[model samples]
Target: MSVLVVGASAAGLTTAEALRRKGFRGALTVLGAEYHPPYDRPPLSKQFLSGDWDEARTRLRPDNLLAALDAEFVLGDPAVSLSDHTVHTAAGRSLTADHVVIATGLQPRRLPGPPLEGVHVLRTLDDAAALRNALAADKRGGVVVVGDGVLGAEIAATVRKLGIAVTLAGPQAALMEAQLGAVVGGLLGELHAAEGVELRLGAAVEQLEGVDGWVSGVRLVGGEVLPADVVVVALGAVPATGWLEGSGLTLENGVVCDEYCRAADGVYAAGDVARWRHEDRLVRLENRTNATEQALCVAANIMGEHQPYRPVPYFWTDQFGTKLQVHGRPSADLTIAEGTIGERFVAHYRDAGRIVGVLGWNAPKQTRTHRMHLISGEGHR
Candidate 1:
């Protein structure tokens, strides 16, 4: 039997590797759109952009490990269309496989702004490299980040470390107010401010002004302009599901899948592209941990070992010399801080008297304990 997997990122590579490890000896093919091999993305905004790690050092698997899978790799060619049993690539190649895995993750959401030379987005290795080079070229210029999301925050922090004046502007009153809440968001804003990043919270970009065909500054809705030599638009990413339009799978925000990540018979999807059945709702998680975990489950189910793919949603972010990790569901109301809220602490989020989430600020060991509570609760459900 032949198995075909589209996308060669964390989800795609992990699913293909898991299939081989789980004893799938049939023909396997992995298709990727990028010219480079699959690499870790979390570091793109951190160490890679900071020049602490090189491109070759970011590969997910070594050459020897990838060779063990013995799968045919079609790099730099994306699967443009898919039928029930057939996959068509942009390079004029049609592949028919016994089973098809759709792991196409996400694409950066482009903003409706002026096209300037210095305006960039971070979603690929090439993107990080370009932004990094731009920052290094003008070490003293101001960098305006258009989004206050985690990616934008990280980029702002890292760029600040490179001696560039960074202006982080977003519509929210605080950075990542939806995910971190007011308390944590305030703390993070303080951290960024302490690091010399100019915060333009509650500010909306009206238009991007350019100087000589290159981005020069960002004009706010109130006619205030933040001088900038470069602009990083980290608005967010959308599920890369445009290619699956003609496919028979249900696409509601993401590929609607069952609890097993199965979109249809003999077909499956994992990662940010798959919004599987969650507790009382369908949710799509776009984190690295979920990608690996869900892909393994997809691999298992593809080999006839059926198991529900319900994850307790975990995510982490590193910014301004502080690392924060979160597990479980977060609600608007968190009762109190289970631990201290200083350099190290575990904030407990409760919903209706039950702890729904645990957030750790530099406390890994303590955070793991509360994370187990979530794991046990999930197992019982």
Candidate 2:
């Protein structure tokens, strides 16, 4: 049997490696859009952007491990389309496989305008390298970030750490409002303020003003403009599902799959590109942990094991001297058990006398224990 894995990130690499480890001696192939080998992306915003870690240090799998697997790698050639059993790449290669795993992840969303110099979105390795170069070459002006999500906040924090003036503006009432909620969000606001980065909460970007053909500032909705030499639009991302269009697979927000990550007969999907069925709803997640977990599950299922891919979403963010880790989905109505704010703490989210979610701000050990509770389907003690 042959398996073709597309998108060569953590998800694709994990799926292929798990298949090999699980004793599948089939012909394996990996197709990646990026020319580089599989690498960890989370660091692209932190260590890579900050110049603490070089490109080689960010690789997810070492050359020794990847060489042992003996899987054929087709880098810099993105899969353009797919059919019943064949994946067509832009490099004019048609790969016929018994099973196809779509793990193409996502691409960063950009602002509505022609590509301007100094405008960046931190998603790919090239993006991080480019932005880093731009920041180094021109260190005279401030940066205006136009998103309040985790990516935006991280970028704001990273630039500020470089002694660069930064202004974080977003449409949310508070920073990271969608993930951390208002209370924690407010705490993060305080953290960034303490770091000397300006915050423009509850605002939207109207236009990106350019001077001399380069991005110079961001104009807000209420007629306020924040001057900037660099503009990083950290607006989330969309799944790279355009290649699957008209491929006869159910494509909603992502490639819709069964509980076992199966899209069709002999075809499976995992990672950000696969939105599996979940209790009368399609649960599509963009978390890095979810990608690896789902890909491993998909590999097992492909090898004749029947298991559902239900994941307790896990995500973390490091910004402004605080590392926040969250496990499971925390509902706004869940009873909160607060330990401490802006310091070592654990905030437990409970429902009906049972812990549903766990949030840790610097309390890694305790929060991990609580995280295991969600994984084992047990309530908080």
TM-score of each: 0.97, 0.96
Which digits, one per residue and each the tens of the lDDT, describe model 2 over residues 1-381?
Answer: 999999899999999999999999989999999999999999998999999999999999889999999899999999999989899999999989999999999988889976678898898999999999978865666898999999999999999999898999999998998887888888899999999989999999999989778988899999999998889998899989999898999988888999999999988989988989976778898888988899999999999999888778889999977889999776554434556666788887767756677899988888887687787766432
Model 1 regions lying over 4 Å from their true place: 378-381
What pairs collide in candidate 1?
A: none
- Model 2 is weakest, by summed lDDT over 10 consecutive residues, at 331-340
Badly placed stretches (over 4 Å) of model 2 are 334-338, 351-354, 376-381
TM-score of 1: 0.97
Cα lDDT for residue 312, candidate 2: 81
The whole-model lDDT of each prediction reads 0.88, 0.89
- Which candidate number maximizes lDDT? 2
